[model samples]
Target: MAATIGDRENAQDSVRSRKTNVSESTMFTQLKTREPKAQENSSTRSFVLLALIFIGALVTLGIVYLNFPKLEEHEKQYIRLPRDIEDAKKLGNILSLYKEKYFYQVLGGVFITYIFLQSFAIPGSIFLSILSGFLFPFPLALFLVCLCSATGASFCYLLSYLVGRRLVQKYIPDRVADWQSHVNRHKEHLLNYLIFLRITPFLPNWFINIASPVIDVPLLPFFIGTFVGVAPPSFVAIQAGTTLHQLTSSGDAVSSTSIIILAILAVLSLLPVLFKKKLGAKFD
Candidate 1:
C-alpha cells in the first residue's frame, strides 16, 4: 500500500511540472511576437511621415509654379541656366522685357521658390539667387535674396531639428561625430564659426543645415549667421545680374576677386572668436 501511495504522489508531481512548463512557454511566445510587431509599427509611422512631407512639398511647389507668368513655348525655353553666362544673359534679356507687367508675380514666385528649395535642401537656390539680380535692382534684390535664404535655411534648420536629424545621426554616425566634435570644441565661439562656414564655400550649405541641429547649435546664431554670411555672395550674384549678359558661364559669379573678398570676410568673422579663445586661455 505504501509503495502504491509513493508512485501516485510521483505521478502528480510530474503532471504539475508539465503544466508549469507549458504556461511559461506560452508567455515566452507572446513576448517574442510582440517585439517584432512593435518594431513594425514604428517603421510604418516613419514611412507615413515621409510620405506626408513629400506630398506637402509637392503641393507647395505647385502653388509657387502657378505664380509664374503664363509663357509661350519658346519663351519657356528662354529660362536660362544662370551658371552658364550666355544662358543668364539670354534669360535676363527676356525677363527684363516683362518685368514691368509681371513684376509682382515674378517676385512672389521667386520668393516662394527660394524658400521651398532651401527648406527642402533642394539644389538650384544659387540659380534663383542669380535670377534675383536679373529681376530686381541691387538694393531690392539683395534684400529679397537675404530674406529668402535666411527664412528658408531657418525652416530647414527647424525641420532637421524635429525629424530629419535622427535619420542623419543613425545612418551617418561618423560624419555626425566629426561635426559634433567641431561644434563641441567651439561652443564659446560657435557664432563666429557658423559665420565663417556661411562666408566660405568650403562646407556644403546642405550639410551645414542638416548637421547644425545634431550638434546642438542654437537657432538664433544659425539664423543670424546664415543671414549675414550669405550677404557677400548675394551681393556678387545681384551685381552679376546687372551685367548678366556679359558673362559666359556661372563661374563668373564667384570670380577670383569675389573669392578673395569672401576669404577676407571669413577671416574677419573668426577674429572675435579667436580673440575670445586667446583671452580665455590666458585667464586659465
Candidate 2:
C-alpha cells in the first residue's frame, strides 16, 4: 500500500512538471510571433509616411509649374535690358503696388515668401533683395533682407543635417563630392571656412547653403557666417535698387565705382579668416 501511494505521488509530480514546461514553451512562441509583427507594422508605417512626403512634393512641384509665367515670351519682349535686372525692376514695381494697396499684409507675405525661397535654395532671391531695396528705404530694406536671408539659410542648414550625405550624393553628386572635400579639409576651422566662403565670390550662395548640411557643419558657425557674409552684398544690391530708374540697360545697372566697392568689401570680409589661418599655421 505504501509503495503504491509513493508511485502515485511521483506520477502526479511528473505530470505537473510537464504541464509547466508546456505552458512556458507556449508563452515563448506567442511572444516571438507577436514581436516580429509589431516590428513589421512599425516599418510599414515609416514607409507610408515616406510615400506621403514624396506625393506631397510632387503635388507642390506641379502647382509651381502651373503657376509659373511663360519666360520665353517675356524674354523676347525685354531683349533690350538684361533679363535679371529687368525682372528685378518689374518685381519691385509689383511689390511696391502691393505695399501701397495692402500695406502690412503685403509686407508680411513678402517676408514669409522670402524666407521660404531662401531656405529651399530657390532662384530669384537676389532679384527679390534688389526689389526690397527699390520698394523700401535703404535701412529698412537692409534689415528686412538680411534678417529673412539669415533665417532662411539657417533652415537650409537644418535640412542638410536631417537629409545627410545620401540625399546630396543622389541629387547633386558632383557638387557634393567637390564641396565635401573642401569642407573636410577645413572642418577643424569650420567657422572661418564658412566665413570665407560667404564673403568670397568663390562659390554660389545657393551651393553653400545646400552643401553645408551634408558636411556636418555646426549651426552656430553656419548662421553667423551667413548673417555677416551676406550683409555687404545685400547692402550693395539694395543700394543699386535705389537707382533702378537710372538703369537704362543692364550695363548701366552696376557702376564701376560700385563694383570696386563690392570687390573691396569682399576682400575685407575675408581678412578675419585669413588672419586666423595664418596664426594657426605659424603655431603648427
Output the number of the TM-score-best candidate: 1
What is the RMSD of candidate 2? 9.5
TM-scores for candidates 1 onward, in order? 0.80, 0.64
lDDT of 1 by residue, 237-280 (tens): 88877666665666677789988998898899998887887899
Q: Global lDDT of each model?
A: 0.80, 0.70
Best-performing candidate as measured by lDDT: 1
lDDT of 2 by residue, 1-284 (tens): 99999999999999999999999999999999999898667556645654564466456545543443333554434312124776666655655655665666546655766776776677767766776778787898888888888888887666555543445655688987888898888777677667667766889888788677776667788888787777777877787778886665444545677768767876776677678889999999
lDDT of 2: 0.70
> Number of clashes in every candidate structure?
3, 0
